[model samples]
Target chain A: MKNNKTDFIQGNIACVEGAIVAGCKFFAGYPITPASEIAEHMSERMFQVNGTFIQTEDELSSIAAVVGSSWAGAKAMTATSGPGISLMQENIGLAIATETPLVIVDVQRGGPSTGSPSISLQGDTIQVKYGSQGEYQVISIAPSSPQEMFDYTIWAFNIAEKFRTPVFVMADVMVGHMREQVEYPEDYNELEIFDRKILDDPDSTEGRFLSTEVAPMPIFGNGFKANVTGSTHDEFGWRNVSDPKVMDNFIKKLTNKILNNKSEIIRTEKEYMEDAEVVLLSYGSVSRAALETVHTAREKEIKVGSYRLVTVWPFPEKEISKMSENVEKIIVLENNLGQIYPYVRSAVDGKAEVELLSPSVLGEFFEPNYILNKIKEAK
Target chain B: MLKDIEHPLQKYIRPGTNYTTCPGCGNGILAQSTLRAIKNLELDFDNIVFVSGIGCAGWIPSPSFNTDVLHVTHGRAIAYATGVKLTNPKLKVVVFSGDGDLSAIGGNHFIHAARRNIDLTVICVNNRIYGMTSGQAAPTTPKNSKTTTTPYGNMENTFDLSDLAKSAGATFVARWTTYHARQLTKSIAKAIDKKGFSFIEAISQCPVHYGKVIGMRNDAPSMMKEFKSKSIHINKIDSLSNESSDDKIIVGELVNENEKAELTDLMQSLRTEVGTDG
Candidate 1:
C-alpha cells in the first residue's frame, strides 16, 4: 500500500492518506457530517503508523489537543465542517499566537448554522480567514478534486510547518464524499516534507518566536523553558499587555511573516487566458463546472477562458488582476451566494467588469449549461 | 537576613521570577507546595511540562517555572495537556488550574480526562470564587455566600469538586486547604507518583476578593484561621451524615484506586495487540 497504486476512494480518505504521507503523527477530531470519514480512516491508519488518534469530546477539545500535540513535537491535524470550525476558532487563535504548526481540514457543508450537512457549498472561504479573532493571516488551500485533496494536504502541512502557523485545507462536501482515483506515491519518504525549525541551542533567548523570518519552536518536553501563551507577549513569551511597542511588533511580525512570503505560498491556475473576452473564475468543486463551460464555449468559438485559485488565501491578488486585464468580463463562479466574489472583484480592481454566477440552487454545484447560458448573456 | 539567604528550591524557579500575588492570596502557597512536591519527587525539569488555564492560579507556573510551561486559553488547559501527554507519554504533564477554570469552562475536559484515566496530575486551586476578575460567584462558591454576582447571597449550591472527580472515575482524589500546607505537599507528591488520572483539590483563599465578600477580615490569617477551624478530616466520615457536617470541608485523600489501566500504557498495549509494537 505504501508503493504506487490507484485506488477509488472518497476525497476525505485521500486527505487521511495525504496527512500520513506528510508525517502527521497525531489526529484529534470529533465526528461531523461529510468529515467523519477522515476521522474514521485516521483512527485506523494512525495505529498502523505508530501515531496517536483521539475522538475528542468536542470541536474545542479536538483543536486544543491538536495544538498541544504539535507543541510536544508531533505533526498534528483535525477535520471538521462549518459548525465545528465555529467552535474551534478560539484555540485556532491560540495556535496562531503561539505559532504552532497544525492542519485543519474544513469539509464545508452549507451553513450560516449547520446548513445542509449532506450537501456541498463554498460558504466557508472567508470564514477560514477571518473566523479566528485577532490581526493575523493564514494559509488556506482549496482542492477541486479527490486527487488534489491528496496532494494539497501535503502542501498544507508543508506550508504550516515552514511558517509555524495553522494552515487550512478548504475542502467541501462535494470533494470530501465524491469518490475518485487517487494515486498513492511509490515511496512516501520521497515526498517533499517540511518541518518547523527546532531550537538547536536550548540556552539561547532568540528562538522565542518573534522574528519576521519566523523563529524555531522551543517545543515542550525537550528541556527548553518555553512559555506558550495566547496573550500579547514579548519575545520571551511572557504576557506584556501594557507595552505599546510589544503589541505593535507582535502584530506586524506575525502578519508580515506570511505577507513577505506570499509569493512562495500562493498558487493559481490559468487556462486559455492568452486570448479571451470573458473569464470564469472559481475555486474548489465549482471550478469543475466552470472548466466544463470554458471547454464547451471553446467549441462554439467563444473566446472565454477559466482561472482557478489553488491557494485561496494570500488572495492571489496579482494573478487575479493579471487574468482580468486581458479579458472583457470576469465572472466569479462559486457554489454559494458569491462568498468569494468580493475578494475576486477587489483583486480585479475594475480592470474588467466582474459578475457573480452561483449555482441555480444553493448546495447543488454549478451546472455547465447554466454557466454557458450566463456567458452567452454576458457576452 | 531572610532575603539574603537563598531559598533551597530557588534553583527550580526562573531567576528574577516574582510571585506577583497579593499579600493574602493563597496562590503563592499552593504554587510553593506544587514545586516542593516536584522537587522532593526528584523529577527533572526537562521531563515535566506544566499547563495552566486562565485564572490567578493559571499564573502559578507560567513565567515562573524554570520548566516548560503553557499558559493556555481559558478552559482549555486540560484539553491541551491531553495532547502533550498522549503525544509523549514519557513527559510528566501537570495542569495547574483554578476551580472556576477547571470546573466551569474546562469542566468537560476535566471529567473526560478523568474518565479516560490518562496519566496526568491535575492540581485545582479551588478559591471558591473567581478571584482574577474580582469576586464573581463560581461553581465552587459556598452555598449562601455573598459574592459580587450573588449580591443577595448565592441561590445555588457549590459543586463538590473532589466528589465529582471520584464519580467521574479519577484514580486518585485528594482535598486540602492552604492551612494544611504539609499534607498538601505530601498529597501532591503522592498524586504525581500515581499512575492514572490524579486530581488534588487545594481549597485556597482569596483574601481580597472571596474573603471580603464572606464578611471575614481582609487578611490571610483570617482565612487560614477559618480554614483550620471549619475543616474536618476525611477519617471523620461518620460525622458527614450529620446536618452540622454538611458545610464542613472534608480534608484528606478521598479516593485512590489502581484497578483501571492508565491511558498511555493502554495505548502501548493497543500497539502490541495491533502487532505494530515498537
Candidate 2:
C-alpha cells in the first residue's frame, strides 16, 4: 500500500526533511539569512532522526566540518546564502580537490557583497560553478518550488555521493521562505539513497585517487590510515606538487568524472517545445513566472515555450542547443543582472537570438508581464 | 648502509619522511614532545587522527606521524577535528597547528570549541611569527615586536592564548615553551587525559625571522636561554611583585576542572533523553 502525506510547509523546512530522508546524518552550518531556516529545522529534526547537527562558529568551519564528517563515513551537508558561500569557497575547493561527497545548499540572496539578505535573487548561478580559485567542475540543481526543494535536496545528496564530489542545490529567498504544499513519502526508506563507493582493497598500496572512474573513499578510522591533503597529490593521496603528469592526470580525472557522466547528471524540464517559435529559458523561482508567461503568451497566439533547468551547473547544453535549432529566439529570465543569460546565449550560440530579462535590483522577483513582454519582443 | 640505532619514538614517525623545518627550529622539539606524550599514554595508533591547519606547525603531524592525518585549510584544524570527534567519539582527535593559524585566523573556532567544551586536544605552537611566510607578526607576537609585516613595530597587543582558553571554558589549559620539553609533554598527557576541550600553548622559537627581528638570540640555544630567564612558574607568580609579574611568562597548568560536560557526551545524553538510539 502506498502511504501519502501532504503538508503545507516552508521550502527550507522541506529541505531539512528531504536531507533527513536522504540519510544526511551530519549537518554543520552557521546561520545566515534566507538559509537559517534550513539549519534551524535541522537542529530540531536531526536528533529525532538519530543524526547530528552542529552550528559552527562561521561559514568556513561549517563547510570544513561537513567535509570532515563526510570523510568520517557520514552523509554531511551545510547551507548558506551568498556571503557565507563566499567565505566557504576555500574549503569548497578543498572538498572538490579531496573529492569529498557533501551537499552545499546556496539559498542565494543578493550580492557581490551582502546586497539584500531578505530579498530573492538568483545571483550566484555562475559563482556556484566558478566561485572557488581553481579548475574544477561543479554539480548544481535549481529547484523552482517547495516540492522541488524537498525532492531536489535528496537528489543533491544522491548525486554528491554517486560522483564523490560536492553538489550544490541553488535556491533563492522566494522559494526558501514561501510556504506551499509538499507531498512527501510516509517512509523515508522508500526514497533512493546513494552510498559512496568504498575501497574494496584498502591496503592495495595502489594510488587511492586512481584516474579511471569514481575513486573509492576510505573512512578515517577504518584502518585505511589514509593521508588526505588539499595540495596537488598523486593517486595514493600523497603530496606531489612538482610533477606535471601528476597534476595534469589528477585535475583531468577530477573534471572528467562529472563531464563524462553528464547524461546521468544533467536534469531539465521542457514544456510546449514541439512547434513553439520562442522559448523562455529560466530556473529556480523565475521558472514559475516563465511557466505562467508560456501559458499567457500562447493564449495571445505567441508561439512561446518554457524550458526549466533542474541541473544548472552542467548547463543543459545539449537540450538548449537542440531547442535553439527549432526555436526562432530564446528569452532567458533570472532574478539577478544576467548571471545565467550568458550561458544560455553561449549554448544557443547565435543559432537563435537569446534575450535576457533580469530585474535591475536584488529584492524583487520577475513579474509575469515582464516575461510576457520579453516573449512578445522575442516573437 | 647500516641504520643508526632507532630512536624510541621512531615507530611513531612515518617511514622515509623527514621533518620539513629549519635547522634549530622549535617545531621539531614540539613534534617530538607530542609523540612522547602519545607514547607515554600508549594510545591506540590506529584510532588516533591528527588534524592540522595550513602553517609550519600544521606540517608537524602529517607526513611525519604514521597515523590518519588530515591537513586542512588555514585556521580550521579545530573545526575539522570537531567533526571528526563528533562523528566518531572513540577516535582520539588532536589538532596541531601554529599561532597565526589558530589564534589569528582560526580564533573563532578556538573560542567556540572551548566554549562548547568539545572533546579534542589542541596543541598550538606559538612561534610568535608566521615563520612559513618569512615571519609576519602573529596574534601571539608580543606588542611592539618587529616582523616582516610589522617593520615599524607591531602596535597591537598579543593574545595570552592559554588565558583565552581558560576564559573560553576549556577544561584543561596549560602553557609551556619548547625549552620545557619534559614539562610540555607531561602537560599534554594531562590534557589528553582530561575529558573536555584541552588547549596547550607551546611558546616556540623561529630563530631566522622572529629572533633576528626582535634582537633576541639568532640561534635556538640562545632563544631557549632567553625563555628560561623570562619564565616564571605558576606557583611562584605570587612571590614576585605585581609590576614585575605583569611582564613575566607564567608557565604551568592554569585550569584543570572536569565538572563541565563534553559536547559529544552531552549530545549523546540528549539523544538518549529524546528516546533515539544511534
Candidate 3:
C-alpha cells in the first residue's frame, strides 16, 4: 500500500486527476449519484487551478456548456450517470456534427432510468455508442482499474484533440467510488498534448472555406469566419439542409476521418489468442476478474485466454474478427445485459460461438470457477 | 442553398411584401430599431451573429438582415448563441426571441445567462401573446386577456419583462413599446453598447392573433392605433407613477446603466492572477 498522500485512488478520482493533469481547464456537469464525485472533486480542483466549473441546470446544458467552453479553446469535459448521459445525447450528436473535441465520463449505474444507483453495471456500452441519433463512429475507452482509468483519460483527451471527436471514459459505480493507490507522473509537462491542426495558407482566401472531405475547425477567436451548425452543412458551415450531396459528403468525410485512422485509435489486449480454443472477452473493471479467471484456468491446463478492450468504440472489430478464426467459442463478461455481446457475435459471424455473462442476470461478477465453468461449457 | 451567407432576413423581406406586421406594428419598428442599432454600432457585417428562437418575432431576423443569422431550435436560441459567442467571442452575438420563447420555454437559459453576465445583447420581442403560434396565452401575456390558449379570461398572472431582467442579473434592462419608435431605437443602441449582458424588451402587437381573439380587427391600422394609445414611456424611475393609468400600457427604459465584470474579463483576470498556475 502506498502512503496516504500518494496512495491508490478510485477510478473516478483518478479520472478527475487525469483530466486535471491533461490541462482540462473547464468542467460543466450536473450532480447525479455514482458520478457526482467526479463533479465535486473537479469543482474543488478547478477552483484551485483557476479553471472554470459550471454546475449547469441539467445534463443537456452541462454538455452544452462544455461544448461552448471547448470552442473557447479550453480542453473541457463533463461527467454523468445513465439518465444524465441520456439527456446529453443530443448535444453529443451536436458535438460530432460540429466536430468539437470534448470528453465525457459516463459512470455506469444499473439503469434504463435511475435504476440502481449504488450497484455497478456496464449497461451503457451500447447506449454510449448508439443512443444518439444518426450514423457515426465513436471513440470509447474502458478502464479496468484506477491506474488504467488515469492513463486512459489522458488518452481520451489526446484522441479527442487529435481526431476532433467526442471520447468516452466508460466506467461504472464500483470503479468510480472505490479507493486505491495511484502513482502520479513525475513531470506532467513532459506529457504530449495534441491540438487541432489550424489552416496556415497565407495567400488562399479559399483555404478557410473547407470544401474538403474533413473540414478543418478554426479556433473561435481566430479571424476565420467558421460557421458551426447541427444541420447538414456545406464546407463553408452554411446550412445546406436541402442538398443530399452535401449531407452525403459530410457523413462520408466524418466517417472516413475516424475510420481511416483506425490504426491510431484501435487498442486491445490479447492474452492467449494464439492457441486458445476458448476466449473470454471483457472490459472496464470487470476485465480484472476475467484476467484472474484466465490465469486460474491456465493452471488447470485449460487453454483459456482473455482479451480486454481498452478502446470499446471504433469497436475493435478487426482484432475480434482475427481471434474468431481460431477460437472455437467466445464468452463475453460484462456488468450489463449483453450490450457488447452482439458486436462480438456479429464480428465472428458464427465463425465461432459467442456467449454472454451479465451481472444483472448472474451477480456482481463471475468467480474464477464460474468463469472456468462457462469456458468449459463453451467447449 | 444560398451560395453566399446573406442574412436570411435581408433575403426574405421583399419591397412590396405585406407578410410582416402593419407599418406601425411593433415588429416592423423593432426590426428597424435593430438595423439602426447594428448600423450605428458599425459591427462587422460578416461577424455579426443573429440568433432567433421560434415565434413571429423570431422571423424578424431571418429575411431582412444581411448578416450571419441562425434560425435555431425553438427556445434554444441562447444555447446556439452561447455556442457562437464562445466559438468566437469577438463576434457580436445577439439573440432575437419572442416573449414566450424567452420567458417560457427558454426561461432557464435566460436567467442563467444573465446571472453569468455573459457579454451579449438579448432583444426580446414581447408582443404579450404568442404570435407565431396564433395568440396563445404566453408567460408575458397580461392576465384576463382572451387568446386561443385562454378562451376564458386568463387565470395566470403575466411576467413583468423588465422586472424579470433586473432579477436575472442583466447589467442593463429596458422596455419600450413599438409605438415608442425613437425610444426603442435608442434603448437598443445602449443595450448593444453595454459591455456585459444587456436586454431590451420591445412590446409589440399581435393584431392577427391576440387582437382578433379580443375583438380587434386583423387590419394593420387598427392594431397600430391600439398600440399607440396603450403605449407608455418611462424616462425616469418615477415615470411609472406619473403615467400610472391602468388603461395605458407601461413602456420606456425601466432599468438603465449598470455594469459588471464581463465573463471574459473575469476569466482573463483570473488567468493573469493564476499566471503559470492557470
As for candidate 1, its clashing pairs are: none
Between candidates 2 and 3, which one is better according to TM-score? 2
Residue A207 local lDDT, model 2: 58
lDDT of 3 by residue, A267-320 (tens): 999887678888889988888888998888889889988888888888878889
Task: Write candidate 3's Cα lDDT for B185-204 as tens digits.
Answer: 78888888787888988877
Instruction: Point to the candidate with the largest TM-score.
Output: 1
| Global CA lDDT computed for model 1 | 0.90
Q: State what share of the real interface contacts each candidate retains.
A: 0.79, 0.64, 0.12
Fraction of the native A-B contacts that model 1 recovers: 0.79
**Compared to the true structure, candidate 3 yields what TM-score?**
0.85
Model 3 spans with C-alpha error above 4 angstroms: A1-7, A47-50, A186-190, A200-213, A360-363, B1-32, B42-73, B79-93, B128-137, B141-156, B205-221, B235-247, B257-276
Over A116-213, each residue of candidate 1 has an lDDT whose tens digit, in order, gives 89889888888889988888898999998899999999999999999999999999999999999998877766889898899877788685787778
Query: Quick one: ranking by DockQ, best first?
Result: 1, 2, 3
The per-model lDDT (C-alpha) reads 0.90, 0.87, 0.76
* Rank by lDDT (best first): 1, 2, 3
For residues A298-356, could you state the per-residue lDDT of candidate 2 as single tens digits?
88888888888889887788778887998888888878778878878888889998888
Superposed model 1: Cα runs more than 4 Å off: B1-4, B239-241, B275-278
TM (chain A) per model? 0.98, 0.96, 0.94
Q: Point out where model 2 deviates above 4 Å.
A: A1-4, A210-212, A359-362, B1-4, B216-218, B276-278
Docking quality category of candidate 3 according to DockQ thresholds:
acceptable
